[model samples]
Target: MVRRIGLTGGIGSGKSTVAGLLVAQGAVLVDTDAIARSIAQAGGIAMPALEAAFGRSVIAADGGLDRAAMRQIVFADADAKRRLESVLHPLIGTETQRQAAAAGEDAVVVFDVPLLVESGRWRAIVDRVLVVDATEATQRKRVVARSGWTPEAVDAVIAQQAPRRLRRAAADAVIFNESMTLAELETEVRGLWKQWAAATTR
Candidate 1:
């Protein structure tokens, strides 16, 4: 049988990098964020509901979701966040499952969910949870370096996510990706992949 592994981490914890490493190990990846992005594009499945709920202001000139505008609205208002999640979550969930189902047995399927710890529903769906962890300082530094977001903005986002302890508690495996070189990270993931591949194929 295929093994479904849930992968998550705080923003700027190098989760996406780790996921890319895992993919190189002959694993199949089902990424929720990618699916959400797809559905938020022009003429995509989730655009109509988004436009209806938030109006034309949240739509880009190209007829896609104006991500910046939506982000501002949702972060400032809980109800707006909820409404946005209500529109996107089901679609993301459905596509997630569809992709997972299509990964054949003997494949190690990694479900890349950024909010796996907070979602409550993802734990039961995956056989294992792998958390990519980093210190809050590292998280803040990375986000600011890469995204050019203000320190205050990064702080707000980090504050909103699941605390590090809770994510550690939920993890079946954890990758502490703080201040590590890319080569070292890749080596760690490769070693872990051998173990998982053996476990699933055995």
Candidate 2:
């Protein structure tokens, strides 16, 4: 059977980097972020529901989700965030499951879930959770430098995420990415992938 892995990390924790390494090592990747983009794009599966729930204010001129407008609303309003997630979560879940079901039985299927720790519904589906860890200062610095987000914006995002300790507690294994070089991180993930891929393929 497939080994379903739930991978998570705070913004700028290098979680996507780790997922890329796993994919490079032959793991089948199902990225929730990518799926969300597809589903929120023009004519996507989630468009109608999203438009119905949030109205035209959240829709861009191109008929896709107006992410900036939605972000502005959700960041200020908790209820809006919940309502948005309610519309997108089920559809994201359905598509996530469909992709996993389509993978080869022996595949090491890695679900790259940015919000896995916050979602509270992934434990039943994943065989293990891999958390990518880094200090808050490091996270904030990295995110601000990379995404051009203000310190306040980064702080806002981190505030909404599961705290570092909470994420670490939920982890079956944790990768501390604070000081690693790209090559070193890649080596580490490749080693894990060899072991995990071997298990499922065997």
Candidate 3:
């Protein structure tokens, strides 16, 4: 049987790095955030609904969703975020299902969902949940170094996500990312890949 793994982490926790390593090892990755961006792009399926709900102000000159403008509006207003999610979530879900179905029969599919813990619905669908974890300070420093975001801005985004404790509790496996070098991280991922491969074959 195919192993459906739900992989998640907070911003700057190196979840994407881990996902990339897994993909290199032949895992089929379904990244919901990427899917969300695709469906909100110019001429995407979600565009009509988003345009109807948020109006032209949230649509860019290129006919794509004005991501920066929408981000500001959604962060400022809870109702706006809900309205946006209502339009985008179903489309993302359908695309995710289609992608998973298209993967080879023996593939180990990983769903990279940033909000896996917050969403609550993924637990039932995935065989295991793997959370890439790091200290809050580590996350803050990484984000600042990589994205040039102010500490306060990083904190604001982290504040909006599920707390670290809740995410750790929800995880079936936790990959601690702080203090690890890239080589060490790759080794850890290799070990995980071997373990998951063994489990699936049995």
Candidate 4:
């Protein structure tokens, strides 16, 4: 069996970026977000369940899930968010596990999960957790710049995630992304990949 590496961080902390670098170094990247998107597409695996839960309003003009609208609703309503998760998380988990299992002994599967820390269900599936970390200020600046969100919006997202201290404590490895150039980040990721390859092969 292959090892499952859970890579995660709060919004805009560069978890995706690190996962990309890892993929470049031969790790099979299993993006939970991408799986969610696929499962939410029209006539997708999770679409019927989601529509049954939230009604047809969550569907977009193209018949896909209206991600923007769903984001707004979830941010405003805790119960709605939980309901959405209940409908989607299992699908994502199943696909992720399917991919990981198919990879088998040759795989170094990296789960790029944004909610790994908050999602208690993940700990059971992942063999190790790699946290991409950055300072709060750095996170705020990056998220705001990328998403055009207000400080309050960024703070709201940060607050909803597991705190940095707790995430760090849970980490089997940490990638500190503050002030690092892309080249430097790649080098660090390559080193980590080698480490993973060695550790998992043994």
Q: Relative to the true structure, how large is the alpha-carbon lDDT of every model? A: 0.90, 0.89, 0.91, 0.86
The deviation in Å at residue 22 for candidate 2 is: 0.4
lDDT of 4 by residue, 89-190 (tens): 878878987887887766788888888888787788778899999999999999999989999888888888899998998898999999999999998888
Give lDDT tens digits, candidate 1, residues 1-202.
3388899999999999999999988789999999999999999999999999999999999999998899889889999999999999999989988888898776789999989999999878888889999999999999999999998888888877899999999998899998789999999998888766656755
Per-candidate TM vs. native?
0.95, 0.94, 0.93, 0.90
List the RMSD of every prediction in angstroms.
1.4, 1.5, 1.7, 2.1
- Candidate 2 colliding pairs: none
Query: What's the distance in Å from true for residue 185, model 4?
Result: 0.8
Q: At residue 157, give the lDDT of candidate 1.
A: 83
Error (Å) of candidate 2 at residue 110 is 0.3
Candidate 3 clashes between residue pairs 3 or more apart in a chain or in different chains:
none
Candidate structures ordered by lDDT, highest first = 3, 1, 2, 4
Clashes of 2: 0
lDDT score, candidate 4, position 119: 79
Q: Candidate 3: list runs displaced more than 4 Å.
A: 199-202
